[model samples]
Target: MTMDWCPGIREACAHWQNATMLQHTFDALQMALESDSDASIDAVKGLVECICRVIIDQLDDPTSPLKPKDEASITEWVSAAIRVLGRGDVRDRKFADLIKHHNGLAESLRVLRNDAGPFSHGKDGFIQALTIYHRRAAILAADALVTFLYKAYLDSQLDPISSREPWERFAEGNALIDAHVGLVVDDDDSTTLRFILPSGDELPINIEVSRLLYQLDREAYVEALNAARGAQKPAQVREQGEH
Candidate 1:
């Protein structure tokens, strides 16, 4: 079967991983240090919202038995799905902290503006609070994703205790799902297993043999990854309107 959703998943993950919460925290701190700017507030709010949405979506179980196709928006879908999972009580703490921090900053900004007072100290305090809050939020989000994926994998398998660290297996599963590289072929099936590459092109080959050679030589997989990167760069550049 064609893995049509793999690209979308990869895009979402890439977006999530590209902007570390720490980086945003630093940016917020810098803006606070310079002056309380609208841009800094927006940046902090945006990061919190993005991480929340990502965690909520992953926890909602897209591959669930009751996966709804008619989710109108990520926010709505996450709101609805998170309810079913009963994750709100545990999940709400970090979210509430983020909200509180934002509200406090807004109030401080208002007070400073009204009083004609220097906003640097107040803004700096908000920045410090936001940094701690964002770090906690990021850790929570990552743990939620990893745990949710682990639980789903365990539920699907016959042996629930196959391994203690299911997150590692989950990571392996994701790579397999993306690269379409690994498969467990039955001895009864005489025909060779063929994995369709990501581009919907290229001849299929046995990934086991590829791995064996890769382990022995190390150069092959490096070359392959490099080639894949090389091939993708120009397309990305072109998409960005670069010459």
Candidate 2:
């Protein structure tokens, strides 16, 4: 079935190994279309959270200390995915502000789900009835937010450099050394190439020194060595020796 609110959502998510979440979202959307109840609104909220979780799982670094907790809110999940997908673009102040706006929208959706969705909590008094218009608005908002984030995720996948962390990008650029050594950047901003010895001990080398020693081109290697030794030219070195 075609999802009119978010065109191409099915195709975009077709490659995912687990389709249960997407199926549930589709069912929820269908329910919303046929009913004018808060139950449908609750389902729309679930759809948004599902999409956010999927994006975060696919894009976030598994080993990062800052990974979101399992109990994170929908807004927190959205923010995590945004941080990954918006990496290269977040440097722009305007783009960063726009991301903040998107986070606000996610928070608003969460608020709507909590306040108006009957399935979320028991109410003491009579609540306002939601019309088909309310269902449509919820679907529209959820669809737009999910679609935007999914597009950004897909775009990041297409660009390898932008998708990788800083150290990974450096490793990818230096093909020869990348395979032989692991790149690491310390908290103090110092970069090192770590080589594992036969005894399994790590031998750390400064990045610049490693580059000079293992440069692929012979001429470039010589030039780097000469530059390190504070020599302008081979002739100048010989002349200085006479003095």
Deviation (Å) of 40 in candidate 1:
2.5
Off by over 4 Å in 1: 1-36, 61-85, 89-220, 223-243
Q: How accurate is candidate 2 locally (lDDT)?
A: 0.65
Instruction: Identify the candidate with maximal lDDT.
Output: 2
Give the per-residue lDDT digits (tens) of candidate 1, residues 195-243. Answer: 5566665444454645655866688878877887899998998989954
Superposed Cα deviation of residue 215, candidate 1 (Å): 13
| TM-score per candidate, chains pooled | 0.29, 0.56
Clashing pairs in 2: none
Query: Candidate 2: lDDT of 15?
Result: 38
Predicted structure 2, TM vs. truth = 0.56
For candidate 2, the 10 contiguous residues with the lowest summed lDDT are: 158-167
lDDT of 2 by residue, 159-182 (tens): 344332233434444576545555
- For residue 94, give model 2's deviation from the true position in Å: 2.2
